[model samples]
Target: MNLSWQTRAQSIAQMKAETFDILIIGGGITGAGLALDAAARGLKTALIEKRDFAAGTSSRSTKLIHGGLRYLEHYDFALVREGLRERTELLTLAPHLDDPLEFVIPIYADKRRNYDHPLLVRAGLFLYDLLAGKYNIGRHRRISQAEALQLAPQLDPRGLKGALVYYDGRTNDSRLVIEIIKTANERGAAIANYVRLVSFRKDVNGKVCGAQVTDELTRESFNVNARAVINATGVWMNEVRSLSADLSDDDKQLRPSKGIHLTVSAERLNVTTAWLIPAIGEKRFYFVVPWEGRVNIGTTDTDYHGDKDAPGAVQSEVTNILQAVNAYFPSAHLEPSDVISAWAGLRPLISSGNTKQATTAVSRKEEIFTDRDGLISLAGGKLTTYRLMAERGIDLAVEQLRDHFGVQAKPVSTKQIILSGGGIKRVDLEAHAHKIARAENVSIETARHLLHNYGTNAEHILALTHEDEALKQPLLADLPNIAAEVIYAVRAESALTIADVLTRRTRIAMLGAAMNCVEKVADLMARELGWSEEKKAQQIAAFRAEYEREYLIAR
Candidate 1:
């Protein structure tokens, strides 16, 4: 069951022939998690995505698996506790993708803002550690201002009261989603990308029993019958929910806000640990996270009312983020030229009655609502708690299945079921990576990168290099990724388009070499997938246009 275009026809045929126990819509982290949980329970499950997996919000996250330390101020203890628990599970399940990282919250003597006080910040860290309990990666510690400056020399020293250090997890956001989808597929779930949900298919009694889906690539239409349907289309939840017969315009639930991040060279920021600094004037804080050998400074949250498909980061948003980072690290005067790339994603924040509240103040809790037609919709949850959210969604789905379809399924055991490439112990991962590095005749850094991203699956790509020595060549100079990854993506990872491989699968696009290597990568893909010259050119053009629109913000 390859996820690539090679098996698309077979996947569609199977979808039309079988009546799935559960049909999931949306291919983001939420939908991926739900599919994994539902399929793990021995239920006949199928998932359809209008775009490539994680093409939207899932791929454009801040790339942290944190427990939302800032939420402590709101007294949302339950949400924080749940997130910490999930963080622990993810670290164990996908050691290669997720790892523990240290974060430093620099305190300031800002008497005007009570929350910025050193004592209060220390108390918050204590509460954060307490919430993690046994799952705590590292206990929170307080350091003197001198010690803080030694850690982050670029930090603004004036009025710096002290700092608190804590531990959180970080991950490759897009890879995590892809692995989850792959795990679900491995468990007898029929999953297809570029298969858009055209409309909801209801039975004679006006009850939704399946979905009318269309293949976005081939433009072929088909019906997939199922016992229950789920609408997990994150920010576009209302659009999908309205497809149901009973849901109306008044049933709108999502209050999406745009969060944007900028990628800059790590040497420019000169910080090894993550920094949680207060965003200039906002009540919320912004992070200067270290990821993929770069400094990821971001996340400006503001109400967005624009195109949901491509939420481009405006110049103002970029400027605001730059200002926040500069405020913390005054020595690092990062201008627009320093920005390697920028990306924006919508947070499917659940709406509250008080419209005046800041987007940051909005709750990040998950809510599952089932309509009269048995269409289940989920919205407004952070990435860290996705598995828990899935368990809850599947529980509700199982209840509906028993009531309507008389199907009995086993309870979810996702916590115990390790994800793909998760069998190796964390302690042994380094030695295993070293062996692969020696066999592949590549640098230890390159081998470790592959191991970190693909875990045990990295050996498959290494084997391809042995079959063809050319596969060991890098896509571009100075990049560690080998050519075999591109081929592996098409043959095994369901990557159909140049954008899919560059942006999500391998992340060459976000690393500031997308335009430079698009033609070469497209040619490679064309050779493997048998794309015509015109189609190859079209794919390259499309990737270039998207990169310019999303990453190259006008100064």
Candidate 2:
């Protein structure tokens, strides 16, 4: 049942032999959520991803689970309201991955811009809290200029004014996607990564009945027959649609927005609470989030017309973020050299012909598009409301199934079902982690890291250390990550490539010394997966190339 390379052969064979009720394309959060919902409802489901799970926008997000407070400016109350509800659900369903964090919006007296006015900001927070209702993490409060400085010493005190403090949730974006996929697989849904949907199979009536899939790793082609096909690919929606049939100029959809973020050491900024700072002259505001012991500052939203697969962070984009961070925290004086890593993601916004509209003005509301060929594509939604998106997408899919195939399926109840590793209570997490630490004879930090990242599944990793003491050693002296994580990713998670282990599974590639540990981790993966020496070398080189391409900013 383990989702490893060893099981991929068997899984692909099964996929080709058996007919499924639903074939899900794209393994991001939207597709993962739908697969879990469908499988939980007792439908035969299968999911395929061309790259690693969450390899797209899902992994490169600002990493907040908050209702978009800025959406209030655009009067996007419904999107914000739905996002708030899903935020609360995720905190309860996956406490280990999502946690509450405090945010402050500093108001300046000298710069009384309409958006930065204290009264206006407070009013927005009021509506934000009202929408959250009982699900509100904490009530918003106002503080004096002095108190604001006390809370965030690094803040620029030149334009002294008060600030508003509110609460929201943050998460490890990639890890959340992986957990959803794993939960679906555990529930009997056949999920395969590195499997690309090459084309579609249609009947004489031109209805999509199945898909032609290819294993990217093995270069093997096969066909999977299904009663329904769901296209959940994010920015690549139009690209996948082309495989079914060409579209006219008017039919071309998706206004992809490029958003880039930079990661710096927490010590450089030294802010305990997250900050929402309005850009000097733009309607958009940049986020200064503290995550994983580092400061994550980001996200410039501009219309993108580049290759979807290679959304690299340009120097101009990085400079914009740096200027914003420096303006907010004058004392920090953060330069490009302070940046540890940088990433870019494309938001799949449903295009409105108004090319004059700013990217920020685009609505994040999701839409389900069904063509005459029965190809259902879900596009243009934020990560916060993925569950609701899935529910709506599946409702349409089920309706199609009943109408076209004459099949009956149960209703979805994914809200009641906790995702994998969600059963552990927050109060008992420390004690449980302590017990595991003692049992495994590893450091407390290491145990807590495992518990937080893998949740209740930490025990499975602890077992690896028991089998081989070498697995308990740290991958890097400064990092808490152990060698066992690399092995567990291969044996338990479907990590086919070194990039899968380093970038998505463990996040070692984003941290410092990523290149230094690549060969070592590759060696462990080779030992477990039986990679030849040449393959191991290839993995190391490929991982380094990806890190330099996607993460490294030119010095």
Candidate 3:
């Protein structure tokens, strides 16, 4: 019953053989969440991904479990309250994966930015805290200019009018998706990546019954017969909806927007807490947050019309982000060279689905629409609200299953089910990290890194490290990850490619450390998966291409 990585063939075989109660297309966060929720309710569910899980927009996010603080400006209190509620549930659901982090919003008297007025910012924070109600981690407060400078140190001091500190939950976007997928698999959902949906299988009335899917890995095609089919592909939902052939609507479904985020050395642009710097003249703001040992900093939202598969930040975008960061933290003076890695993802804001005229007005509220062929497609949501999105999507599908399709489904609250690698309620994570540090003879940083990434399941990795001394060797001096992580990825986490292992499974690539130890990682994966020299070489080349595709800012 191996669900990931080594079980690709087995998983595919089961998918081809079984007639599923629900078939999910697109393996991003939304699809992954729907799969988990449906399976938990005892539905025979199968999910397929054309590329990899979280390979699209899911993997590329600002990585925050937002409380929707920004929505306060438009007086969208309900959205704020909903996001804050989800934040509370997620923290309890996966503390190791999602945790509270402080944010500093520096105010400058010289530059009139959005919410620059101390009283105004404080009012918004007050609403933000009030909205959180019982779930609030900490109340937002106005800090003295001296205190603000003490916290950030690098913030531009001229005309500084103090700052306001607030709290929000940050996450590893890709890892969270993988965790949910694994949890769903544990609850009995047939899942496979690198499997493309060729087209929808429809009945005489053109209602989708299932789909014709291809194994991208083997170039093999098969028919998956399902009672209900879901399009949870996020940005690609429009393209997926087009698969119904006759189910065509000229009215565009999604108003796609591209956002790019870049990471740099913490030493280069240091911050203990996340910084929410207001992008001057722009109503929205920018985030320069501390992640691992680096600062993840853009996310300029603009209408995107380009290749959806591989979208990278161009030279100007990169320069713009760097320039903004430098303005906020003049002392840092970060250059393009300081950018370790950069990547972009398109937001699936549904055009026809949106009630608001402006695209930004769509925000994170998700919309679900059923095609004439009975294909359910979801669009326009953010990572923070994914769990609720899944719960709602499953609720609709379950109702359709019973009333429309004559199948029975009674959904239980997913809020109760702890995600895979979670459920360490009583144990103190910090204390555990210290204990593992002494036991494994590794630094506290390395121990904490493992615990945060893998949760309680990190024990398997620790055991591997103790079993083999060489497995304990760190991949890079800057990165606390070890060779055991790569081995664990292949054996457990469905890391069929070097990019999956480095980029998402362990996040070694995000830190700009993956390329440094590609040979070692490849060797470790080969040993576990039994790859030949030629195959390994091809994998390496593919990873190199992906890395460049993501990070190479065309000048």
Candidate 1 structure quality by residue, lDDT tens digits, 1-555: 346676666778899999999999999999999999999999999999999999989999998898888888889999999999999999999989998998988877765322366777888889999999999999999889998898888998988877889999999999999999889988988899999999998889888999899999889899999999988899999888877753444545478899888888887888889988776555677788888887887787888889899888778888888888888788999898898898889999877546788888888888898887889989898888889999999999999899877999986689987887777777887998789888779888789888888888888888888899998888877678888899989987899999899999988878787877788789889999999999998898888888887667744
Error of 3 at 173 (Å): 0.6
Better of 1 and 3 by lDDT: 1
Regions more than 4 Å wrong, model 2? 112-115, 249-252
Ranking by lDDT: 2, 1, 3
The window of 10 residues in a row where model 1 has the poorest summed lDDT is: 245-254
lDDT of each: 0.86, 0.87, 0.85
Summarize candidate 3's per-residue lDDT along 290-319 as a digit string, tens digits.
887788986888878898998889989998
Query: Candidate 1 lDDT (Cα, whole model)?
Result: 0.86
The order by descending TM-score is 2, 1, 3
Q: Estimate each model's TM-score.
A: 0.97, 0.97, 0.96
Give candidate 3 regions above 4 Å deviation.
113-116, 245-252, 353-358
